[model samples]
Target: MAKITASVYTSHVPAIGAAIDLGKTQEPYWQPLFAGYDFSKEWEKAQKPDVVFLVFNDHATAFSLDMIPTFAIGTAAEYQPADEGWGPRPVPAVHGHPALAAHIAQSVIQDDFDLTIVNKMDVDHGLTVPLSLMFGQPPQSDYRWPCKVIPFAVNVVQYPVPSGNRCFQLGKAIRKAIESFDEDLNVQIWGTGGMSHQLQGPRAGLINKEWDNRFLDRLIAEPAELAKVPHIEYVREAGSEGIELVMWLIARGAMADVAGGPAPKVVYRFFHVPASNTAVGHLILENQPA
Candidate 1:
């Protein structure tokens, strides 16, 4: 049977991707930010999985005001990198695991969580940046991402988005779906976006280091309690975009501990500020083997 080996959390800042693509990672401004992911890159190579269940929000790229799915899952055979105003980044296209993805969709929907099944769509930086940070740039000669990815997008851009509690419950349903799959596969769920930096209006460059750190601590030690936090608090304290943190709860909810198993092992944790216009945070938590 398939198993969810771990959950990864991080902020997907576009500028970080630009720095890597432009060969500016070693520069003074970006060096520290990239350094934080050095361990994650190596750790990813060691704990390589057959597929990555990536959770992120599309920033007005694929889904705009025309159509919005509160929760969308990509079951396509492949996904292209999107052109988010500044053109597409020089990155490998993402391959998808269709069989497993279809299974997850069926299982999740039967469990009562509505999901839009996308067969064709372009993936934005929210999805690609996380891949680059954790896997680094692929060689020019061979430019395929390390593993097949299943993109799970949430609608945080629009109002009436899924609450933290709803996302958490859906994750539990995802765990159940993965475990039920008959294939012998390894999977990792990643929650990307957020660490408290606003990018709009007069508060264009707001950063709350204190609130971000406390949130991280609670996420590691008491995620269930953290899930109870309301949307207004995230907006008021962390900023509007800070609501992205709710996606992290989905990944956290799929862990073993949430299902009456042993607590996950925190393999790595990192936090940094001013990555473009956001505070970057990254974490790697491995489920304790049963």
Candidate 2:
């Protein structure tokens, strides 16, 4: 059976990549921000999982408010970069693990969780930024990503999003799906978004560094506690519609390893202020006991 080697959490701030490309990550405010991810870069290289199943919310790029899937999984052979309002960020097309993704789809279905499968889709910065942060560009000499990615899009942008408990349950289903895979491959799942901050209307620049850090701390040691938080409360407390942190629960749920344990080992935790109307928080968890 395939094992989930690691679970990581990172903020998908498009400006960060733009900062790196424009030589702004080294700027006084951004230098330390990027520095925080140095260890994550090292860890990813060391683990080098065969496939990364990423969970992120599209920024009205791939799925607009018109039609949205609660949970969408990419079962395609490849995914191209999406064209956001400004333009597409120059990046290599994302490669997918169709066999595994298909297996996950079947597992979720059997487990009674309806999922939307994308055979052909374009990934926006929400997926690519984390990739760029965790793994640098394909290579200086080549223009491709170092690893293959399976995109799992969540609909947190639109209202009536999935509940925290629902996201958590889905994670359990994902773990079962992955464990049933009859292959020998190292797989990693990532849940991206939030710490706290808002990005719409008058609340555009909200920042709660304290709450963000506390959320990270509790997420590692006391997930069930965090899981109890309702979506409306998250929006009210975190910010207007800032409840997207629920998606992180899905990632956390998958890492829970329910058959075994009490808590997962948190290898790394990072929190940064002001990553464009959001507090950039990053975490890495191992399913095995510490």
On the 0 to 100 scale, the lDDT of residue 118 in model 2 is 87
Model 2: per-residue Cα lDDT over 224-270, one tens digit each = 67888887777766776467688888888887455456567789988
Model 2's alpha-carbon lDDT is: 0.84
Candidate 1 structure quality by residue, lDDT tens digits, 83-148: 999899889899999999999999999999999999999999999999999999999878799899
**TM-score result, candidate 1:** 0.98
- Local distance difference test, candidate 1: 0.93
Model 1: per-residue Cα lDDT at residue 168:
91
Given candidate 2, what's the lDDT at residue 22? Answer: 74
- TM-scores of the candidates in the order shown: 0.98, 0.95
Backbone clash pairs for candidate 1 read none
**Clash count, one per candidate:** 0, 1
Candidate that would win on lDDT: 1
Q: Specify the poorest-scoring 10-residue window by lDDT in model 1.
A: 195-204
Assess the local accuracy of residue 190 in candidate 2 as a C-alpha lDDT between 0 and 100.
93
